[model samples]
Target: MSLSDCRILELPRISDPRGNLTFIESDNHIPFGIDRVYYLYDVPGGAERGGHAHKQLHQLIIAASGSFSVMLDDGTERRTFFLNRSNYGLYICPMIWRELHDFSSGSVCMVLASRKYEEEDYYRDYAEFQEAAEKRG
Candidate 1:
């Protein structure tokens, strides 16, 4: 509903002399159950993605490698989050418009979604998203 509703979550980290490890479990490390998992990679410089909002979907976005920023707008407020760590993730709620941009080379953006992909659940147009957000509010 608002930018305040979005939060950065810290995942479990296991440090070892060999290598550091991070793990995430559905509804354990994230607020919602994970029904889908995907990642974005090989993004060219200055390119952008995710210019839409979901009606009832929730997602946890993490930077598994390199770095990137997510711009979030919740109808009334806007905020930007820089994700560069595999042990941290950004939790996005429904009705919030999100855009992913400013990706560094070799950046891997991983997303854990609450539900499987459905075209009807997406609000791709900003104007329509604003109207839907207003109605929900």
Candidate 2:
């Protein structure tokens, strides 16, 4: 899919004077069914992660604790999203390259994936990802 397919989603939030709560339901708040869930935390300063693309996986990435930036590339164009709110998330479509960087200390990145982890589904090489994206087009 193209870069236009990617979007930001606002999750349900319940505001309380004591604290706030955010929740997501499969195929309700997200476009796809949830098959796997993962999170990244305690990332050291200046470290980067997620330098790859998935062939058939859809992901909803949220900043559950602190802040971080998600750089997205769809073979032709590139964009960056800064995530710091628990009520917001970035929806990444398949066949796009993504990188997570500039993670603040104690940042927790929660990822809701549409499918289980499959090594074969990942394209880690930028050139290979571009070629694969071209083939998909």
Candidate 3:
């Protein structure tokens, strides 16, 4: 996939004076079926997460609380998205490199994955990921 395949998906939100509620449904709101769910929180300031690409995973990354930036790189192009809203998710297709940084205090990043975590599906090396991405194109 290419960087153009990545985009922000706005979740359904219900606003109220008491509180706000938002929700996501697998295959109903997202483009893929959800197989795993996780989140990142309590990150030390300036600490970065995600410096790899998935070989065959579709992911929807949401800023559950606070704010942060997500950098996505394909073999050919790069884009950065600032995520601060709980109701907006960045949908990342397969074969794209991702890095999360510039986290505000108390930021919580939630992720919905299309597959269970598998060690072999990850491309931790940028050069290797680039080479594979080139081949995929």
What TM-score, to 2 decimals, does candidate 2 have? 0.98
- Write the residue-wise lDDT of candidate 3 on 64-101 in tens digits: 99999999999888999999999999999999999999
* lDDT by residue for model 2 (1-137), tens: 88899999999999999999998999999999999999999999999999999999999999999999999999999999999999999999999899999999999999999999999999999999999888888
Clashes of 1: 0
Model 2 ranges with Cα > 4 A deviation: none
- Model 1 poorest 10 in a row by lDDT: 128-137
TM-scores of the models, in the order given: 0.98, 0.98, 0.98
Task: State the C-alpha lDDT per candidate.
Answer: 0.94, 0.96, 0.97
Residue 39's C-alpha lDDT in candidate 1? 98
Runs in model 1 lying further than 4 Å from the true structure: none
Positional deviation of residue 14's Cα in model 2 after best superposition, in angstroms: 0.8
Candidate 1 deviates by what RMSD?
0.7
